[model samples]
Target: MADEDLDIRMFVDGKGPPDIDPYFTEIEGAEAIAQSVALRCYTPKGYAPGHNIDAPNDGVFLPDFVQSTMTPHSLFTAKTLVHGEARKVDGVDSARVSVTGDQAAQRMTISVEGEGVDGEFEFSLTVDPSGLGVTST
Candidate 1:
């Protein structure tokens, strides 16, 4: 059996008014799990009300962390945050996260590989100071 979720867009370009739709798109299986992992990891700690409160610093602090420094420690921290969040998802059996940064472009890429009920899955997201962009699953 596969999980299903509403296909809501998390990151917006902000070029114009937000896209309004009365109907919701549905996503299923590995894609749904992957999207959940991405959203959880992308959200900053303490931002999500009543979620993961025990682990206060669970979410990625990419915007502030990457903007300030690109040190090895920071990259490791990002990886840990992402990995921890990915592992917490219900369908995930195992998860590995990698965070790489480009100092010149001030961009960071977070990649996740895992095994789930639907089988193996991979997800990646590119984030810059502007915001999160270019997600693949």
Candidate 2:
């Protein structure tokens, strides 16, 4: 349900100082998913989203990836692990990534089908002061 997407209000809206874990986790998950998708679609040569010569033109990220688990949160990042291959075989595959989760956990299911690759990618993760990392598929 859309309610599960990312409830920033849960932590905001006069609720409290705002538990940034949810927002941070959601952002990390999104970045990871995009990276995974890019890896699936194919990233450009010397194309990196960084700051240094390799780092892209992105500004200072909310998470400077200081304690960032896998070289600054990514597909391989401990907080987000996207498994299962869903390639667009005929290049017409109706690929869809549906996300669902709560403050406790977040899950992403990627479905792709066209001609070449057909499968489902399920990524489950949880990031919080209580815990962090991909729990399951």
Candidate 3:
């Protein structure tokens, strides 16, 4: 897919205003999961292969450490709604947040389904702190 299409968005202030319902029905659980995902961001852990790099600074390269959905091994833990979608009354959307220190970018994916109050929504956020840096190799 194109680069733009691969991007995701996440809400910063945790859950929004009063009317906005968060995808994570349980506030406490959602917060915990979100925090866990945040931890996965670009950490100074792991190794870089093939090159003469001194050591494993901090990078989860393409193939080995790649992760899309919230996998079992993910450092984060979340309590999602029974049916996936957050409650409607809150007016918030579903979301996932991830942090990649190597990329230096925070990503969030929000799915808003309706026009107004009756809309269905969801989101995923990823925080990539790595930015556009290349490993020394």
Candidate 4:
């Protein structure tokens, strides 16, 4: 990688859970060199509405408003490097970036001594020059 080609930046757009919008703000403070990319990410959790039930007056007393629990959202990011030449076919140059991590949206159910969320989530990101486009075979 050439020193001028190396760069560090945050990807601004991606596909993920609905309502969870991700926007790349800026790249981390580092040297911008060819084949070199560095960045940090911050993700916020989506807010949900809570339900409440209530009863009043003489007769009988009922619980007023139901208690709700909110789940915390986490963000997992990875930094990777690509060392390969761009493939040119049909007058187009293409490259690929692969990202491996966890899918923050997959929720799992768990019932042990107490109630908890459990599940397996896999994150695999492939950035091709031509997204979802037919390749020259």
Provide the TM-score for each candidate, comma-separated: 0.76, 0.23, 0.22, 0.16
**Candidate 4, superposed: residue stretches over 4 Å from native:** 1-10, 15-24, 29-125, 129-137
Q: Identify the candidate with maximal lDDT.
A: 1
lDDT of 3 by residue, 1-137 (tens): 22322212232354211122344333322332232222222222352222335444333322122234434343222223211222222333444322222212232222212222323323343222222111110
Stretches of candidate 1 exceeding 4 Å from the true structure: 2-23, 47-57
Q: Ten residues in a row with the worst lDDT in model 1? A: 13-22
Instruction: State the C-alpha lDDT per candidate.
Output: 0.66, 0.28, 0.27, 0.19
Q: Write the per-residue lDDT of candidate 2 for residues 1-137, one digit (tens) a residue.
A: 13333322222221222234454434323323333333322222233322124523212221212223323224233222122222312222334333333322332222222221223333433233322233213
- Rank all candidate structures by their lDDT, best first, as comma-separated numbers: 1, 2, 3, 4
Where does model 2 exceed 4 Å of error?
1-53, 57-95, 98-118
Best by TM-score: 1
| Candidate 2, residue 122: lDDT | 35
Error at 63, model 4, angstroms: 60
Relative to the true structure, candidate 1 reaches a TM of 0.76
Count of residue pairs whose backbone atoms collide, per candidate: 0, 5, 42, 9
